[model samples]
Target: MPKAKLKPDVTVFEADQRQQEAIEHLHGPMLVIAGAGTGKTTVLTRRIARLISERHARPDEILALTYTENAAAEMRTRVRAELGGSETSQMRVCTFHAYCNNLLIRNGRNFGVLDDQDLWIYLRKRIRELQLNYFVRAANVGKFLFDLNDFMRRCHDELVGPEKYHAYVERLVRGELSIPRVTSSRDADSISDQEVLGRCREIDQVFQVVERMLSEENLGTFGHMISKAYELLNLTPELLSQERAATKFILVDEFQDANYAQVKILRLLAGEEKNVFAVGDPDQAIYQFRGASSAAFEIFRNQFSQSKVVALEKNRRSTTPILQCAFALIDKNPAIHATENNDAAENGGRRFQRRPLLSERDEKAGPAAIKDPVHAVSLTAKDAECSDIVHVIQQRRKQNACQWKDFAVLYRLHSHRDMVAEELAEAGIPFSIENMDISNTAEARDVFAIMGAMLAENDGASLFRVVATSD
Candidate 1:
């Protein structure tokens, strides 16, 4: 028996050329254009570790934020692994909402906001109540209300609160301003001055309800969570100053997915020192549906003209052909391609193209190697029987000479699974459906009962549903 050799852990001094550049350059702002599997996480965690272990940065002052709790946890885990428990324990790695909640708990009262409000729990309920009240009679106002909620949230993300929103409403109601033509859910109306004014009034009504609720009841919406934090930072200058002084560096993960409000929060926290490290790929910006602005990343990068941009060109994930195909697919979009190239070039990627420079995986993981490894075969009710699909699966299993675990069947809609499942069963093939469609699940019905009870105290139906469905 032989013991495997354990290589010495790579120190900051021993970092790869590009990673070393990102980790060592800690003075001002830096943007790392790290593509998928480029070890952006490596750069981020290592940089934080470097600051704690070498630069004498107070762990408390370093704020590392991400879009999701999962990402924050991942970064925290990496930092913990990189710089022992003592150093990582003092640092704050959190999502935007959690970080804002921290500020709210500490300094929100100083700004007269989030002080007595149930911003975290009842915000959604409050918004829904307002929409039901204000737009009860409007046609298809339910859909419009959904969009209005998003529009207001975007305002919050942009650090625009009730007062600023009222100003915009005044202009719109007066026909002095025109709504920008939009292709998003936020697009309400701007057909004519009269129509625009009508829609403006509708929006204003919803906002007025929101403001009154917040001011009188001290209850706020999710929008207020972020915007109020921005407000708290602004209204309490001393607190902001103290915070800026305390925070030496801010590292933002998935910068491309950051909407306007999150980006603004980071910038304000960065303050004049501008010690922020943001790592993201513009090509990977896919949060457009929920008010994320990919342009926010580019705008921030350009704001600091002297900010060093490092491109993590080599990818450790996908094979070259797959990367090439992805590049070509995304490059077809003129806007995305242009943004990627421009940012990459500015970020010191002279040879930067719309796609990432990919390397070989341990084994081939590309289209060329796997000839239609998975394909969807459309079926009609009249198309023979389920055997068509089951037989295909069987043939593929035998041809590839793989086990049942190696094969998979996916459905776009969950209900569509039953028919294929029945076929699989009849064919004596084993299969499993991955995602849950709550409508067909007892657990979901129980949840509905609970939510229904919360929404209406006197709803006998929901109450009975809860009692009857109880395990």
Candidate 2:
């Protein structure tokens, strides 16, 4: 596929110079620190467009990496529209794993790696050989570990440097054995080992074997891919140089959510050039449980000589009171590293307008017999009509009255829907429940309609064959 064309020159608004630097800066490692709703994505999209238009980066060479498929799609759609391209064919956008798989598959023969389908089987077998006991015991512990590692990394980034965090992790790992020894030595009357615990240990041993094999193959997991991508690029100077030459600028969104592996990948890709821009909010960095290292953001200036940090504190969501409440809660986090500029502290100091939530009893108070303008009527009975009226107010607040797609219900339990749904019906509000089994719902009808449409075309036989094979 050909490269994506550059977007037209346009001045993009970033809250500060740091944001502008991230959006307009070309080449090299950079970081932008902002709070939630601080236009991080907007800055990132503009940066990508700026690189293509001004920096002359080829669409293929400029790899846009994201954490999820939904995020990738969002970026791809934006880039495609901005650059004007055959998105499906030209855009080389994907999550880190997807990107690595593509790289391995396309260049697999160069590294003696298997094809995509075969690679999965190969990795599974190798992981089994690794014999990682943690994974074997719970079957999901490996994922949990990765998540926990990410979260820990983010916490470390926001509080301390990676070196300190690394040391902390090492100490924790070494301390695990001491607890059991200490307990055994202290209590001579207690049994040496519990039977159930022994059985669990045996399973752990089996998992360790599987984990050992997986790590040995070096086929690469998500963490491995982020780590290996850097190594691969660093080793291949020509390819690395080509990417640097083609793409003048690099911008990363949600920079706080970046783990060490991702930071390494960005550093390698950026090389010595000072064109890379990273943007994220430290306050919304709740993903530290994943391998997202916040140090990449908190310590970017320290890590890179040319890096500049920017803070965007304006909030687009929440009222003044709501923002004040959230700020008050977030201030309680002891681990939050303060900035020299003290923007967060200054912004948070402003008092919020008071707006108290009505008590359940107050809300349940009945409407008075008098026509009141200043004081609102309160519920006083278990009357369904009054409850339904209240429910409508609550439901409308949660779900907008736009197209059918705009509405969604977030219920704690399925039974909780009856009252709200009945209220909606009484108010003549329209909604579609998406919880029904898709096979028995309108989705099935739509699928059949599309299938019928396809069958009417010239390639009807292929469709028929597929249906027959499925059956």
Candidate 3:
């Protein structure tokens, strides 16, 4: 493929100086610390466009990867628009899973990694075969199975193979051994080794059973795609070189969410050229439950020689008060990134080491000049709080044209859903759950729907649907 033409002068593209600096940096590895609403997707798309248009890079040679397909699609749309809808069709715009899936499909056969089948039935059967039904009630079996599945995936994400997993099991079984690889969570120190050991054994057994079944049935999991692809690349230098040659430039979005396997795979693809452009905000990482490591971004920045680091702190989405609230949380002990050091100026004046946040949005957002309109309401009892909320909503609707959907009640736990749904139903509220499609997966859930219909009208079918996916 021939190289594409460059984008026009500065006047053609209106962006912040820092954003332009990040986009213009088309050479070696570059890291952009894009805070929330700092136009991260915009920066990423524009950066890729600049690489193709201005830097004369072939579209097909560039790979832009995100954590989600939606984000990838959005980036593609923006990049195409930036490049005037020319020379962007072949650019690899996809999620990590999609990218890994493509690589495995084309080249996995030689590595004993072929196609994979559905995991839904395999999971249900495994739960029965392991006698997990006895340990967990039938209603909670789905939760047990799903949790086991997540544990297995996390293990694979950490690159813990079955043997090492079995080792963990053996040590746990013996009840006298030190575990390797301490968890990176803040709760790590407080967690009991035996508890972790028991869970590790459970995860290991699931891994063994599920993997064996997958092998017999010619099925593969998403974890297989990542781990096996890494294995394939490691065992075949020609394949690696070919892959690297095909994609001369790689742009990784949400780099802070990269785990051990992702970091390794990215490094392998980067090769000697190291033409990786990663963008992410460490302060916004919330996927650690899925084995994501924000430190991966820091490690990449620290290891790469002469890597350019750009901080995009300009807030265009939220009010200045909201930014202040968020930054207040981010500026605390663990939230503040190690790279941010305000005292570095006194130490050696090295690049003025600290990079603080800035908000361009108006401070008038919170109406500081006016007295607060907040009020307090006392309920007859704790249970009456629901009635109070419904009453307030009704009042708001009458006075301000507020719809039922205009109000929201967010809970941190799925366990909190049933109570809220019950309250809403009692109050005749028309609010809806954001993601209530759990029962849509697997045909066995049809039985669940039938059972749900047979149950009482107030049995919380919506909550049942959410839980049935796991069951």
Candidate 4:
């Protein structure tokens, strides 16, 4: 057999040495520590094209998993552009949830999965069945259900089932587990140990009921879909073997955002061949509260012991000043440095070391130099903060002769938007919120009422709503 040759049109050969190494790697596990603006997407798409062009793996056999649907779509489009639509038509590029959901759809006959809407409907109907001591009030029922759903989702992400949760609660009850004390005055409303144990018991009871209901109805939520897929792969040797054979290569983007369940699923799929390539930056990890592990690099290293690590240190998008400012801010967090050092010590002193980004942009060649890459301001009240922000934007617009489209206001929370929007509107400034929910708007409500009246025919409430909004 002759060795495979790369296609002449492939653009992966033009990448820098580190990126080229990651893209051209033929076998075994590899991790690429890609920083912001490091062309990680380029590396990923080019790697897929290279794999196909070199005849290492067919397009259909390669699986690319991303954290978001938009990222997956973008990756698919780039790969299609490289290899042509027809050649890459069968490639799998999707979110972790989407991949798991597809598997459950195809092989989860024993487990009937409930989507978000279905799960919401079922929980809304059966919520009252789970008797609770603290959160049993009628007014807080919605909050209780939401918190319960979130807790259960987190448990599922960690691969903890109802049985494990119940056992843990029992251990708490038996004094096998200790509760940490509330240290701050802000935690004055924190429950006592007895109350904490009581809540745990209630949660356990709720978990058992929900699991039983799912089992009886042969239904599972999106979280359950992931857990159930892992179960199928682990317990069924034949299915696992078939899946491993089918998926020859696995490439994960934004790997730091992957939870334990997703990581476990990938491990199972990789099997012994371990043709897994993950690219992500630990500094960009922001989903820890939602089960994304902060020590994702360490976890990946531990799992794939033979995996080679590569770093993309060039900052191709940002200026030198911006990179320097970011580095300074991040350096204040000693915990990150400590973790990196410890990981290096544990892994034969060959960690994916963090280095200052080398910006490709020629700062001196630009028309205007960046005077201040970062600015800081402190305001006491929310109103004052919003006012100052609007004032700054107005001044900047006037100075630069910029349009409204050139300005953007970002808030940490959705609650902050109302005040900022109020300030913007009062100043006669036009702005649009990115993910505003228009469903609850007056016009949307009126349209919904009209549709409801048309569908029901005899719905007096809907007709009344439509009539009330007409004038």
Candidate 5:
């Protein structure tokens, strides 16, 4: 393979030294600790471009896994821009689930895997058959199905199949396993050990039924797709080897948000070559509820002994003050220590390598020119807080002559929005809530009426709705 060189005309050549280093690194397991506002995507896309342009690897041999479809599309577009459509057409840039789905679609028939939609439909159809001690009533069937789906997804993400879940629940039943009593919320009732065990047993029962149904019908869910792919690869060394041979370079974006099954699939695909490039910030891991591992960074380090760690600390977006505020907040995490040795074994052995963000923006230009970028406000009550927000918006609009669309109020919770919306309405200020249901809106009703009129020309109700809504 030729040494990867940065061409002066290439955008990657203009990247900072650290980014250039990360891009130039062609082999071995590497971890890029990309903090917020850092150009991780730019580095990742350019690296792919360099790999193809310098003949280190062909576009088809590289696999880039991203957290979202948008991210994957952006990466593909950037790589295409750098290397052109002809050279980059064969490259694979997709989400972990997408990759697994594709893999299963191509090679999963040998192990009897069915489509995810079919699996879901089967589960819904057979939900009544899975007799459970709790949530078995007709009224609670919907809740049971929802919880069952969530539980199954979590189990699959953690690589815990029905057998594993059943075994674990049996241990709990036999008193071999114990759970610590921790109240998740002050207002929530504390669950007893017996209650926990009961729920676990019920979930296990549902899980086993679902698994059996899947086995009998060869049906699989989205989560099962990933798990089944892992199983297929692990059970068949020849197939695994073939995949590893085809995949010369593996680049994972948002690796911190990757679940256990995703990491396992990556491990199998990377194999002994370990030509894996993972870029993520552990602190930015916000998908724990979705089964993302908090110890993802540590797991990567432990799995790849020859892994090289790099930090992209230069934030191209935020100002110095904003960076300082962010640093102060994140530095409190024990994982962000400078270094961890035996002395720090008590503190989870230092999972992260600290990289303080530095602002690349010019202090005297644009938004960076603002003297006070951050503000702290304390309100004694929710009512007061909402009032204060309304006051601020009104004052800002009056002072700057800004339109209502130019201002935005963000709430940490949807519940908080109700009071704020009421406050804004009382103040005669117009605002729109993101993700609000628009089905009842006048525009949506108008569209629905038009559609109904077109589809049901003879229906009196459809004609009435159209006439009522029309000008």
Candidate 6:
């Protein structure tokens, strides 16, 4: 495969100081504070290319961490285009969960675990022991299972052990127990003891079977992979040393989105002298609900005292108006470090906009630099803000503003997606859910069946025929 040439200034749009620094550094624990649309993906791809071409790091030795399989695929595609070929395939471009799966599957029997379902069940039992709220309404076993599966994927083994999951569960139950009293003053409180009791019972039943399976059948989850990997590394430090010896660089994208288990894996892999680069935006840290901590950056900083912090704040995505609106919305959280001050006029600037020339400036000034000024607009009231946004969206629709493909509705949680999903449904608007795995589809049973048959005695054709006979 031909190598994609390095042309950071020309190839990548808005390749700013921070991004350029990240691309060229090729050393130590470095944190890239990549703001939205700041060409983070571009920098990452270039960084990977540099690692392979200049640093002489084998593609297989470098690891690129992502949040989702789709993001992983996107990263792989971009990196492949950047480096050009089966080269990027050698590099492990995967989510934290996928990395865990790789570790666990490769070394399953060492932990006395076999089969994913049994592993999931075992992990669920431990989660219950930890008293992790199987659901908002515990009686909702379906919801519990759905959430449990996801939770298991994230921290399978951490919950498997009695310590972490136990503490997590205790805290969760205590919080739930206090919810009723806390909301008693509210005239319209939603807390229900009956719901909790039912959910608790369902959890108890599910856990009982899982506990039995773990003790009797010896099963575990993906967290089991992390835990096992840690154990294996500890048990064979020389092996990990060898692995680290080969890896000249390990770049973790969206580092802030990583949980405890993942950080542990990286810490172990990075060891003492290995170079590690983590790029993410803490302001966009939305997975606190799922146990991700931005504090990993702080920890890494402290651990590697020589580390340099780089901020890729100049966004090359939204227009002045869009950036202003997005930034305003993002700043609602207290944790955000407000670099752009109260006065939006001078401080705020838009790096990029999608469209034809709107102003007289464009007509006279040929094409402005991609880093042309963008003015920030403050949103005073929720209704006014919504109205303003609706107007822009409506205008876009009328003028063929941006293609439906260009438009995206982003939120911090699945629950937040509900309103838009419902509205889209009612309006009969067709849209597909992005950044989700095919394995997460409602037809996961079919996938499981196919996988099971492929690995088992039965052929996939026979299993498909059997599964297709729904009636």
Q: Estimate TM-scores for all models.
A: 0.72, 0.55, 0.70, 0.78, 0.74, 0.64
Which candidate leads in TM-score?
A: 4
Question: In model 3, how many backbone clashes occur?
Answer: 4
The C-alpha stretches of model 3 lying farther than 4 A from their native spots are: 1-14, 108-124, 127-144, 167-206, 302-306, 331-333, 336-356, 363-471
Find the 10 residues in a row with the least total lDDT in model 6: 351-360
Residue 468 in candidate 6, Cα distance off native in Å: 19
Off by over 4 Å in 5: 1-13, 84-86, 108-127, 134-145, 173-175, 179-199, 215-218, 334-355, 362-369, 377-471
The candidates, ranked best first by lDDT, are 4, 5, 3, 1, 6, 2
lDDT tens readout by residue for model 2, 1-471: 445665543533323554565566565565666666556776677677656655456556576667667788888777655665534335456676676555555555122222222333343434544455433565565453443334333442333333444454444455543223312235534634443344334334443443344345433234444444555676888877875665555566666676666665566666666566766765566556664554545445545654544555555433444455566666654343324233425674322221222122222343522222232346666455446454656576667654545455556555566766776676666766654445534346446545764766633323333343342
- The digit string of per-residue lDDT tens for model 1 on 11-120 reads 43244578788888778888787778778888888788777777448678799989777788888877877765544667889988788877887853422233111232
Model 2 steric clash total: 45
Evaluated with lDDT, which candidate comes out highest? 4
* Residue ranges of candidate 6 with Cα displaced over 4 Å: 1-14, 84-86, 108-160, 163-212, 215-218, 336-439, 450-471
lDDT per prediction?
0.67, 0.52, 0.69, 0.77, 0.76, 0.59
In model 4, the runs with Cα more than 4 Å from the true position are 1-14, 84-86, 110-127, 134-142, 173-196, 332-347, 350-353, 363-371, 380-394, 401-471
Per-residue CA lDDT of candidate 6, range 1-471, in tens?
444464434353545565677889866777776777777778887888877766467788888888877788988877766654535667888887676566655655433433344333435445545444435344654445655555545554333543454454455566644422322236425657555544544444555455455545444544565666776666777767876776667788887776665666777788886488888876667676556665656566655566666666665545554565566676564453212112224546321112121222233344662334544458876345434544555567779757666656665666556555666565545678765655654367456656666676634332532344334
Clashing residue pairs in all predictions, respectively, total 1, 45, 4, 0, 0, 11
Candidate 3 on 1-471: residue-level lDDT in tens?
555654453434457888888877766888788888887777788778877776547789999889876788888877887776684678899988788878877874422222112344456645666644233543677666666667667777877777887886797678667664345658777867766665566666666877776566455667777887787888899999999989888899998887778778888998888888888887767777777756666567555655766778677756655666666667662433334222343553243132345655553344443332335577778677666776777788899897777788767667667777788898777777876656544454556545654664533432334343554
Per-residue lDDT, model 3, residue 175, is 64
lDDT by residue for model 5 (1-471), tens: 444443344443357888888999988988888899889988898889888888888889999999778788889888877665534668999998788878777884423332333344446666678877756753767655665677788898989998998898888788887763423547335667877677777777888887886666554567777888899899999989899999999999998898878888888899888999999887888787778754777777767766777778788877778888888888776563222332245574444556578777743375636456778899887579999988998898899998889888988876797899999999998787776767755577657657876887544434444554445
Ten-residue stretch with the least lDDT total in model 3: 109-118
Q: What is the lDDT of residue 247 in candidate 6?
A: 66
